[model samples]
Target: MNRKATALDVAKRAGVSRSAVSLVLNGRGDGNVAKESQDRIRLAAQELNYSPNAIALSLRNQRSRIIGILSDEVVVSPFDGNIIGGADDVARSRGFVTVVMDTERDTARDASAIETLLDRQVDGLMYVTVGLKPFEVPQGMLRVPSILANCYDEHPEPQLHHVIPDEVKGGREATEHLLQLGHEDIALLAGAAESPAAPLRVQGYREAHVAAGFEAREDRIFMAGWDIDAGFHGAMKLLDDVSPANRPTAIMCANDRLAIGVALAAGRLGLSIPADLSVMGYDDETRIADTMVPALTTMALPLREIGRAAMTTLLDSIEGNTAEAETTVETMVPCRLVVRESTGPAPTR
Candidate 1:
């Protein structure tokens, strides 16, 4: 095996003292070492293919360059990975690494995982939730900097910086699309009824109905889990209620997974998409949206960006620079509409 070249070798080859070579190579020799000697050291290093050890550099700075991510849910949806992916991109670019853990959606376990990260002395922490329930943080452990993703703590006062999709806006936009296509009697296939996200999105749908002089009928809204099976069952219930001839022309599902179920249920009822009913979903998951019989029309969330923002903001807060006051720093990013074959003008003229 070839011996790795050291600073001493470079110095000897350059006809200079090892100390002089060290100073010049480290970029700390400015005005202290001769310019000619600096140039010689650089050339010697290049010829010897010398490279500094990154692990040693990190050790010197007392940094592992790793951040910790605490979560209560593993996969909320395809968007779940997206948010975390976005955060990873930002963190890696900044020379940081991330370690993620989940507590299976339990608040107590979520808090415990966070405490573990603190014990590990991570540079920063990101707390993520799949649903709307607030994952409690330790009131006493204020030293750990944490940013929230896809969930909020609902603190009566400002306690953490958070980044999540603007569900209300996404809900309104999906409903408005259906309404624009002349679907006034649209149904909302929502996630869990108690989800904070659910209520906000329902409000947006209400706003759209109100704008069109529609009553936003209570009977039209159905609550279901964020899964294809849930949507399928919920759609079946709606299918059982009315004859296909008189049923609502559109369904706005809470997320893509649910929308898939809706489509499957409609098929079982012998209904053709966009001909008998127009369907839309949120949190566009590629596997569900692109692979469906008719590609699903849905909304896109910047999940990855939310992840990155969580990492960065938490780091900032941990460093003692609190995020902008309680109101100004809204890390919530809005969702974008992704029109596809799944949605279209209502069956009605």
Candidate 2:
């Protein structure tokens, strides 16, 4: 096989010095090296397929260039794994690496996992949760440049930056979508009260109603668990033994699993989707939402965006690029509305 290309080869090809190659590749070239030469070095490296030796570079900079990610069940669960994927994407692009440790929802193991990562000399840390909630920031996390994704610090005076989806806006937009489609009477299957995201979504649902000059009926909102069964049962209470005029024109669920349950209930009741009753879901889960019988219209969490934003913040702090590294700040990424066949104009009474 041909010998691997080196920085010297790249420098020669780009007509720059090897030291310039080192500076540019290590991200210290902005002011030290001319922009035009930086471009040439990068292009030459690409053409020659030359990459810097990560181990040697790390030793020289006294940084491991490795980001450690702690997750609450992301590795084992299908939901919210994209958050890590997004974080890794940014890390790789910036010449850094990511190492992840999953607690599998075991809060007791968090401290130990963090200690393990710290022992490994990771440059920074990031904590990601499967859902939006608050947790006490692990003490070890404060010892390094770190950030949170899809979760927040529970401390009275928060100590870390966090990136999360705008769940309240997601819920409001979902309800508004139904209302704009002429669904004046809507039922909400809010997720469990334990999840911080549940109540925020409910608040959004109510806000949309108030904005539309409609009263959000408390009786129609169920703090149902996040599952197919909860969705089915909640929907039955709304549609079963109720007259068409008395039934809600649309049912909004806190998650796609719940939406699946709603569909099952609708099928048993001989109600056709969108024609008789509209259905909406949140999270836009993989395989479930888009593959439902009529497909699903839902609000999508910005999982990847949250991850990317969180990683970017952590790296910025580690590299001394931001002064807010020591300050408490929150970043909220907006959720997207994905329209599908499950939602349409309300049926004429």
Candidate 3:
């Protein structure tokens, strides 16, 4: 069996002292070692396939160079996987590795997951969420430089850093687009009331109406789950019980799934999308949104960007580069409006 090459092998091949090779490789040889000797050492190390011991180097530097990620069910969701991908990409580019764990949204498992990552000597931590929700920053996580992604702490400590989507702007943009198309009578199919995204979106919806010089009808808004079923049911209530004169000209769904449901409901009622009624959704849900029959016009949340920003913040904190005097800092990434075929000019009665 071939033995692994050592620093001594590199030094021997370069005809230099082992210490000289070490100094050159560790970036301290500029003035101490002759330029010719440093070049020889580098070439010899490459030829010998010799590399420094990461463990020993880390011990000496007091840094593990590993970032720990804890998520609440993000690992299992196809749509949410971008968060992990983004974080991993940035960590790798910065010469760090990532260790990921999914807590499955079980608070009971958070402590153990965090403890295990801590035991691994991770230099920093990132807490990610599959959806926008208010969470409690785990107490144990405070031991390391940490950041939250796509989620925020309801009552944050000064040390917490968060990167989340600007749902309010996204909501307003979606509604404003419909309004610009001459639709003043619009219905909102909102997501779960408990979700942090829900209220922010509602606020934006109201803001858009106010800006357009129209008072949104309170009865036109329906709160429901962030799913196709809730959207279907909500649409039924909005379209079935109301007379045609009272029916909204457009429906703004909190998510693509709900928008799809509204489309289906519209079809059942013999209404053509954008011709009889326009529909808009949030969270472009690329996989579904663009493929729908009419294609959904929606707001695209910058999920992957949020993940990357969170990692960047955590790395800054780990390196003592943050300038904030407070313990917590919040950052919001804005969503973009994705125009598609589902939305159009309001139908003339």
> Which numbered prediction scores highest in TM-score against the true structure?
2
Cα lDDT tens digits for candidate 2, 1-349: 9999999999999999999999888766767799999999999999999888899989888999999999999999988999999999988867899999999999999999999999999999999999988978879998998899999998888888889999999999999999999999999999998889999999999999999999999998999999999999999999999999999999999999999999999999999998999999999999999999899999999999988999888887787667643555899999999999999999999
State residue 74's C-alpha deviation in candidate 3, in Å: 0.7
Predicted candidate 2, C-alpha RMSD:
2.3
Ranking by TM-score: 2, 3, 1
Tens digits of per-residue lDDT, candidate 1, 21-72, equal 7666543466678888888888898899885454774586575656887766
lDDT of 2 at 26: 78
Q: In candidate 1, how many Å is residue 189 off?
A: 1.3
List residue ranges in candidate 1 displaced over 4 A: 1-63, 75-79, 240-245, 318-329
Candidate 3 per-residue lDDT, tens place, 251-314, comes to 9999999998999999888889989899999987967999998999999989888888888777
lDDT of prediction 1: 0.76
Task: Arrange candidates, best lDDT first.
Answer: 2, 3, 1
Following a full C-alpha superposition, what root-mean-square deviation does model 1 have from the true structure? 7.4
- Please report how far candidate 2 places residue 231 from its true position, in Å: 0.6
Winner by lDDT between candidate 2 and candidate 1: 2
Instruction: Kindly indicate the candidate among 1 and 3 with the higher lDDT.
Output: 3
Deviation of model 2 at 327, angstroms: 4.3
Alpha-carbon deviation at 191 in model 2, angstroms: 0.7
